[model samples]
Target: MKLSSPENQAETAVTSSLQAFLETDIAPKANRLDTDTIALQRALSQLNQFQFLGLRVPKVYGGLEASLLTFRQVQALIPRYSGAFAFLQTQHQSAASLLANSENQVLKERYLPAMAKGETLMGVGFSQLRRTHNPPLTAIPVEGGYQLAGKVPWITGYGYFQYFIIGATLPDGKALYGVVPLIPTPQPEGGNLEFSSPMQLSVMNATNTVAATVENWFLSEEEVLFIKPANAIHDSDKKNVLHHGFYALGCARAGLDILENNAGKKELPFLEESHQTLAQKHQSLSEAMFAALPPTETSFQYRLSLRVKAIHLAQRCAHAAVISSSGAANAQSHPAQRVYREALLFSVSGQTKAVMEASLNTIADYV
Candidate 1:
């Protein structure tokens, strides 16, 4: 896990490159267009030039083939410059991971290399999988393929993503996953596919997130990824919550960085002590979480607990930055205020019922 290790040297190089990009390009305009969807497109194009869209893709497909740990580290650095950028990139990375790990040879051959080379960008539309009420999206077997009919509540990076990986439940109680174009030509009126206007939000409005409805959308066999039983999906999801902690930690680290840079000699000792304490906790929890990869139920529970802790610490650190800056931090453009808003996003991102229950139980013990 050491950054200096030979196995991790490539990760170091990527991180260094991202750091330079953040400082030189992203940070300068991070607060300039919080309400502009076009801003995300520009940032994504810049990221494509750096091969960031392919960070996790296999080397054979022209990607950097970074390890999961390295991917988390790079993700952690992104929110420091722009949380919306990090959020969109996370969706892209998730899609890339799905394509890379799919069992369908044709699906892999058709998309992985294009995705790795930045010629294709895919978004994820699986939030419907978490709904507790009403039936989930269903797939009906048809002559040439399956017909998908249902609604996907939230999909980010809308205009920027050419395609999306959607999930539907089969009648026999299996999950069906496929990649479909976001905007198909010959608009299907009340058929096939349609999307709503972008949602307005208190923050990260630049991401262009939207809701979509698919009415008997046909997904040919070649378009399908892998189908798994419901239980398998549940099992896989439980172990994947740890990477989200890095996003919160990244915002916290950004706040701390701002505080340290602005503090005078007299304020240095107190600020440094606070920074070190949180940094140590973040490092310790990160190590433990990764060590438990492909986690068992016990380890999954532990990871959720640590995730909650990281979220609260991020909020605290961001709040501390606001305090240090006094009245100036009240400005919407202030980095401290931005980090504070970004910290709120971590609570909901990648959230599940199990994670929610665990977070609540942990909070109750202190209350």
Candidate 2:
């Protein structure tokens, strides 16, 4: 991969833009939100207007064509304002990234442009618990293309998204992925689809993760796109995992920013000494963690592990910030409330803390 000189500058620009949005749009509405439904949709629309939704698409498709590193930096910024918005943006980019590997020239030309324009949203359909989330090779030949029958749980942006990239099993049990356009057409007697309320979440209340079921859904051959080897797709998936890892970075930064901005206010005579000690400890710890990441394959795992650790650390920072703020900081009206909620959400992304720990251990063992 070619490292570009503009990557850092791009990251800085994205961060600054997101911070501005958070301060102006998202923060004011966090408390006044109507039903969570209205709040989430509104946030998404605002982000789309800023073209944050197409951060990963190629410039040819009207995207910023940002490097993976740049995208990670942007991801970190989203949670600083709204974790839900960040989560949604991640889903959109993930789908767009998958489209990069697509073979259907027509599909790519059609959808990629629309995605860049923010006229459409894309999501993944690969959360079958029993099976690994590799691409599907299933070619259950049907009249149009194939009958894609499979149960996918935990679709992040279901119901609201227009395009969903689905994974399924070929008759031979190999995995293949299909890009299905989820248009809101007429339904059957009961319903062709069932939408659920947001799963009660510990954090990231704005990200509406919902379970979905698709029965023998018909997909045109164009929808099948390129059913390439799963290993070919793994490389991109790894990049995405790392990029998503930046969410923790943003959360931790937000927590630390809040803490530092109010440090003097936190200085009581008794706690002043402890406050200085905590600040130094966190600073050194963070520096060491950041330094441990060298730009190598091994560093990928290290960075990922650190991101998970950072999520927990950020939560600690938030706790400290609230405590240092003398309890009034925990009020729902305070920005810290939203930041704290996002900190919790950052800790429990689609892959939970335990799962991430296992992945880290696996990566270390492999190395």
The most accurate candidate by lDDT is 1
> Which segments of model 2 are wrong by more than 4 Å?
1-15, 31-35, 129-139, 181-191, 228-241, 261-266, 269-295, 299-301, 326-337, 352-367
- Model 1: per-residue Cα lDDT over 1-367, one tens digit each: 6447664776687678888998888887877545666766777787766677889888888888888767877877888788888888888899999888898888888888888877889999987765534645888888878988898888887888899999888887778889988874333533577888889876788888898888878788889998878656667667676768788877777777766665654376877776677668667765665565542345666777777877777787788788777898999888888778888887667887777787677668975
> Candidate 2, residues 1-367: lDDT per residue as tens digits?
9674675676567667877888888756654432276677777777665567777777788777776555655665666655666676678888888786677788888888788777888888664422444422234766867775545666676555787787776665455677765543333422243445657765555556775556556667877765554343444444444444567666666666666667666455644654565556556655555454335345446556665566566676677667666677867766666677776666656564444675566547753
Q: What are the RMSD figures for all models against the true structure?
A: 2.9, 5.3
Each prediction's whole-model lDDT (CA): 0.78, 0.63
Clashing pairs in 2: 135-175, 135-176, 136-175, 136-176, 136-177, 137-175, 137-176, 138-170
Error of 2 at 3 (Å): 14
For model 2 the local lDDT of residue 306 reads 60
Candidate 1: regions farther than 4 A off:
1-8, 184-190, 265-273, 290-298
lDDT minimum window of 10 residues, candidate 2 = 129-138
| TM-score winner | 1
